[model samples]
Target: MSRTIPRTALLAALSLVTAAGATATVFGTSAGAATAGCKVEYQITNQWNNGFGANVIVTNTGDPVASWNVEWSYANGQQVTQGWNAAITQSGAAVSAKSLSYNGSLATGGSTSFGFNGSHDGTNAVPATFKLNGVTCNGATDPTTPPTTPPTTPPTTPPPTGGRADNPYAGAKVYVNPEWSAKAAAEPGGTRVSNQPTGVWLDRTAAIAGVNGGMGLRAHLDAALAQKGSGELVVQLVIYNLPGRDCSALASNGELGPTDIDKYKTQYIDPIAAILADPKYAGLRIVNTVELDSLPNLVTNVSGRPTATPNCDVMKANGNYVKGVGYALNKLGSIANVYNYLDAGHHGWLGWDDNFGASAEILKQAATAEGSTVANVQGFIVNTANFSALKEDHFSIDDSVGGTSVRQSKWVDWNRYTDELSYAQAMRTKLASLGFDSHIGMLIDTSRNGWGGAARPTAAGPLTTVDTYVNGGRYDRRIHLGNWCNQAGAGLGERPQAAPAAGIDAYVWMKPPGESDGASKEIPNNEGKGFDRMCDPTYTGNVRNGNSMSGALPNSPLAGQWFSAQFQELMKNAYPAL
Candidate 1:
């Protein structure tokens, strides 16, 4: 399934049983015409030193709260550092949390919850007052403060493994979405996995990605840990939700604003890091794919994205992109088992001079932000949620053809590179020049690079379509690299493997092949589901609707969910005969 959507239906079940062991503090219900049937329950999910993690479920017992807003005040000088599923603001002792766009409409008698990470002095007490809209609760309970402070032990940050034996992952283990797997199994041409895959996806789209996703991630880890025998447990997480995210596309927009860098760190990364850092999970190896479109949009921003908050420009100006990623790498990297890979745009992106050096500089800056060098990072990823061909089969970096000396083409730079393989090789060298260690390798998302069958390009030369020319295929399958939905004619690339090429560590199906990119236009279910017009077949044009998609897939499920047609097509067209 696409990494864009969360399995929300499983959120509640997952959250209730996560490793943090939450404690729900119930409040007395107020009954009156003026009160609005509002009752809130506060749960302290986790605490350590001066910081704490919490969950708040606000219940509307009386009437529907369309576009609801919840306001509360801190009692003992505790301040909310970051929050999710709620837009929280704190002024001294008072804190107010407004409902996010996705969770504002809570039905009567129904409840929705939000989560956060906060800090306090020696005394941290839960607030006694809560107001839904403007009405105060009848009998709200307050939490007690601890009398004594305990010394906090600093967690160990392991040095990078110098030998192959010290590496946590013996081989690359690709995560499979259990929910998507089941959906695929139920399809017409079903295939159920005999052994459960090692990784699981945690989405951070809108407010839902944080609130409901925690439980899902916990459950996935719990299950994987339970069955893990001699093999190391691997979990793949997508750190996707960024402000102005996918600015170039409409289907996978995020809830955050470009400038909310502090919030992004506190609200988004903290909670996820907390889960990973839990002592119980220390035995497992976790691979975090940080911020998919963050760096990439910046690359595109340098050319063509002449907007005020060109996704990358805004992130750079506010320093959120680097800061957020740095915080994640440092916080999660501090955990010996957790591996962080920053998203380096696909080969198609970094292939040009306009894009190359800039991406490497960003990587260096991020390392600086994390208070470390590039060598500390696990590596960078390419072709994430993209359909760029894995390798340029017939052409080398110096091959000359098609009116330009490979140097003048939009796909090649003056540096004499023409394909993704060359791009990654050159990318490794650039990063090394900037202080990345020689051992630092590259990873490719071999999920859907297999653009084969009738649409696979057969003939070469004078190939105007950049994808076909680079891919060594005559009929390029994707509408554009920007076309991220359930693409037509695109198939699964190579399965997970170690050391696919020199300087390349692994080939992974990072984007699960069969999952729908999003719902198609002319079909609708939920907000941001099915029918973005970008996925509409009738609208023949570039992903932004200016050119034609050569072999586009039909409208399908919500992004991240399964689409039977897309799955079958992928298996049918898989490269290396999956």
Candidate 2:
């Protein structure tokens, strides 16, 4: 689930939904002969007792520039606390934001955006005027057009309150992303599950607005509203993009450095919180699946473990993962309708007796860091963006062959649990013991774990040896439990359903079925993703998989990017086949 891109955090289509209604001050020069002009849209997205959130979009209406800057003054005595997508600074009543390395350029007709959180003394008003590159912006129309009226006032939605439901998805219809749906429906026989709800991954700060013309947070929330129509609807969002994310994996390496925790907070999480906190989205249930493969790596891939790596060791020592997750939980959980679910690694990774208890404790540690508590977490999700089977109907974890325990089998590999369901149930129990709420629930990512096909075993294996017995019956057909990539035999798992099992809130397709795990070979891109040998079909193996050949599909694309081949494979091998 790690895909890195140094994309600008542009706040597009966000002015329409704010707490106290938006005040758009479209600015351009009045001079008819102007050759260099700009239009700035200043909006107060969220306002509170003593603080507020603002988004500014700067459009270049004149000549192009290598870089640009926007300056404005606040009528009220406001102090900027944090900002993103630009370098913001305040001196007295004047505040200025300069372009950053990635988002500086502004061509004619091009636009970019930035947002910030500020503290005010009650009266917060939008600035009357703005300046771009030291030129004052005065008129509503550009040089070519006659003067015109500004856009109408934004919708007047009442500020949301802290009245969260006990279970956000209990009686709600989950939102199906039209973007993902269209992609699925175009594929052959994809209409069967094309409408299934998948997590909207806000992988970078740019995603808070929109990335590559895709739907931004506000647009998705607005879409969710249209889909609501009266009955409750749950919008699942994956809040990824921690500094040094997925340290154990190369393919998913993130853009933020190990110490860029501040950037993660301000640039990534803050704007998302601002958008979700908007009153227009109050009625919709927002479920945030917190950072995946992060906390677990702090447990299974740090120094002292045989599978440990230097990058993981750096993350463990730096403690940014703990700080970042805690901060995100604190901010997003504060929103009444937002349910925060931390990502717990799958059974194959953490089911070992030594790893299970330790992983949960570390999560508890992260949950309590940076002013966050266990209360911030509504639940936990497992097997996200992975191919672990939801259930093994044939053999049991307690089963043995010729007096040999399944735990001794090569596939089981001394793990305490054999499948996701059993491991999730056990993890929930373990979490409860560590001061998590007794009512806390679990979610298993059945997205790619179905393993249904003609190759699937219909019955138990021969009682010859432990390895033979477990391998013959196990639904997950990977060479090793740790061989996570574009797995060749993986299939679509269960469709999203609320309360599918006891102590489980839902079985979800958190990772959409069609997306790739990683590229099979190195491909260059601006997105920070790297080529991991684990995704290469010819890769022999690593310590994590006990030197087994990588069971990955050939010619895969970058992680998170759609791969048509993988999508077809998933639908073809789907359990309850399409």
Off-target runs (Cα >4 Å) in candidate 1 are 1-168, 171-176, 192-199, 205-215, 302-313, 370-376, 401-418, 454-476, 479-482, 522-533, 540-551
**Each model's TM-score?**
0.63, 0.73
Compared with the true structure, the alpha-carbon lDDT of candidate 1 equals 0.60
* Most TM-score-accurate candidate: 2
Clashing pairs in 2: 4-528
Instruction: Write the residue-wise lDDT of candidate 1 on 1-578 in tens digits.
Output: 21211324223333444223433233334455643667765655445566766666677766787876777777678878665567788898877888766568877766666656677685555555677776676552323221111111122223454422223334333333444443443343433221123234455534323233333566556544533334444667777765556555656656666776667677777777787888888767777787776665555564454332454565656676677677777877777677777788766555657667877888778776846555458777777877767765655556555554555434343544544566777787888888876667777787777766655655564466443465454233454544556777777776666565777766666676566676675554443322456666666664332255524576576776656688788777777554
**What local distance difference test score does each model get?**
0.60, 0.81
In candidate 2, what are the lDDT values of residues 1-578, reduced to their tens digit? 22222212121222233434454545576475488788876655445567766666687888898898898887779998766667899999999999877568888877776766678886675666789987777754211111111111222223223466555666677876766764665455664676678999888778888876567888778666655645667899999899998998889888888999999999999999999999989888899999999898988888888988899899999999999999999999888888999999999999999999999999999999999999899899999999999889888878888888888998888899989999999999999999998878898898899898888899888788988888888888989999999999888988777777789888888998888889999999776788999999999998989999999999999988888899988988889676
Candidate 1 contains a number of clashing pairs equal to: 14
